[model samples]
Target: MENQAFQIGKASLLTKQSMGEPKQLTSSIVILVLATNIVYISNMLNLVTYLHDRMHADIASSSTMVTNFVGATCAFALLGGFLSDSYISRFKTMLIFGPIEFLGLASLALQAHLPSLQPPKCDTVNEWNSCKKMSNLDASILYLSLYTVALGEGCLRSSMASFGGDQFDENDPIESQQKSSFFNWYTFDKSLGGLLGLIFIVRIENNKGWDYGFGVSALVILFGLVSVASSFSFYRIQRPRGSPLTRLLQVIVAAFKKRKLSLPENTDDLHQLDIKEETFGMEVLSHASGLEFLDKAAISHGSTGAWSLSTVSQVEETKIIIRMLPIFLSSLSCYICNPLLVIFTVQQGNTMNTKLGKIHISPTSLVIIPLTFQIIFLVLYDSLFTPFARKFIGYRTGITQLQRISVGIISMSLGMCVAALVERKRKRVA
Candidate 1:
């Protein structure tokens, strides 16, 4: 009877553990991510045309507006990351920002549906070239709605990946492996969602109407919010560490304050919050070389306390960010090419035979071709290329992250070169 009671207790404990584990959390979060991407990408795919056709903006003005909108969305992601790390928890950040995005989409849809909110309809036959510019009121409404969506997108981009990661515990070997798998699948899911938006949603916007497309996107985002909320009980929430920017600032200030202080020969002489371990009680990284001046922040001159003194971890954190800046800047080449490609591709598609067999394809929908290729390439790399490379190279891994990034940079440069050549050919023919 005692043994039976013990077994029953064990089973109950196992049941509770299983209940809390991240079995379906990835699926739930992926759905939210998928929905969000669909909303964002669908709008973006046709934004140039929307500005040109509906708002009566000139080509240069429309192109500039689209470029600025894209830039704002990317930049706002940093603000979102700051908010997530500093004041609000990731879950709360998502909950707040998700609604903001939904409202923006709703406002955009309302603007499209209400004729008064739009510019006077262009006369395609006779007055197409002489269309009136969008009035101040219409321009204000359009920009305000776009920026609102950008703000929400920025927040979600910063928070969602980290929030999804928080669901799995790294200490458990099985869960840690699952977390790695989650990242791979999550990326594929996002790409798939973007492809769907480019194909189906853009088609609807072009064939049926703009109002219907925006309305559908708004509804899809609302559904994503519901899906996320449903899985709240299962999510593992991480508390925000005090702002990383503040910590960086504290290190800089402390380092500058003690600029005249002499360098110590022994690294052990440096002040640390925990002497036994480095970086949050984990002995993962040894003290990195270079930026020897920042190390002064960790020097114990006197009992000046927290502002004047910093842990080795804090000083190292700042140094790590400084070291990564170059790599980050290098990656921007790909992003610079993105908007230019979008603008040129749409213009080219307008002049090309866009009919695929029986169906007429929108120029915006051409985005799906690259997206489909990306998905196929990713699948091939994961399933075939990686294993072959690993074996051929006699290494456990196929390629280093930095090497992969370099390859991507080279590929992007080549693509841009090819695009320039194509443009020149088309112009020569014309």
Candidate 2:
């Protein structure tokens, strides 16, 4: 009887664990689908290159216009974050903002067809020259459309990330681990979107027209909206964390009142500490005064390190700066490499193919190759390499975003070196 009871209990535990996997997978799939669509449309390299190559806009000018999209999106992300944390539910936020991205795609398509729709004032010059050399009105409209797209997509990105996280019960260890794994898959799907957009969608756009490319983006956005909507039944709704302002104030107050703040010396003490004290503890009050005094003292000393933060914060900042330096230097090389892919491909299609026996290739197709490699690496590292490294090194095994990002940087650097070698080979042949 005792053995039978134990078996029943074991089976019950196994069933519960098995049930969680589907719940986790469903939520993750929603995130993955949305992530894929977002990346595909946002990083459409051919579209950017098309403007630069055909429009006679210099790299700097074209990049600035592209940067405007990023800026607009970032601003919306801040707004979205505030709303998600305060008044709005993550589900509603995603549902509301996701469709706005489709409007951006529609606007882009309109801008492409605008010249034919509206007769130009300078018909003499415009009729003779290409639309690229036409009046700036078309360009302005095109850019504005892109900015609107960015704003809507940015809000969706912010809300969805939080919403995906909210699906898991954080208190459950197994569920938390499942959620962490979901993020890896989430990133993988996004990379897949970027790869396809770079390789397939961009080529379709370039071959067909800007309108076609924007149309594809509209389709992707629709799919994303559908995926998000379907997950409504699966999602376990969560309350927002409130605004950053409130969180910040809580931190400051907690920091200043350290003396009154009692810590759990033991589990029993935790209960005692939870109870509100009638008066502010004198020791905590003194500690607060000491902190203020330290700030004043550090200010008088005119020290760079002083008056900023405590030792822990300073060390953390130093570590962050150190990590950021390599990425910053690498970013310069990345900027140069990014444009070369499109420029070379487009030039080959237009000029080199005419003179040499070179075949015309789509600019977007070149972007796809690198992103495919990135996706492969992302998965391999997450599923295989990271675990292997952890086992051998006996290091802490878990998601380390910093480490993953550093690996990407290294891969990008190697890619640049290979590109340089390829450039040298082409020059030698020439």
Best by lDDT: 1
Q: How does model 2 score by TM-score?
A: 0.65
Q: Write the per-residue lDDT of candidate 2 for residues 230-349, one digit (tens) a residue.
A: 655445555554664543343343334343333333422111111144111101111121223222221111223222222222222233444567777766665555545544544433
Query: What is the per-residue lDDT of model 1 for residues 299-335, given as tens digits with 9 covering 90 to 100?
Result: 9887566679987888998898888889999999998
Model 2 residue 175 lDDT score:
65
lDDT of model 2, residue 387: 75
Candidate with maximal TM-score: 1
lDDT of 1: 0.79
> Alpha-carbon error at 162 in model 2, in Å?
3.0
Q: Report, for every candidate in turn, its global Cα lDDT versus the true structure.
A: 0.79, 0.55
Query: Ten consecutive residues with minimal summed lDDT in candidate 2?
Result: 1-10
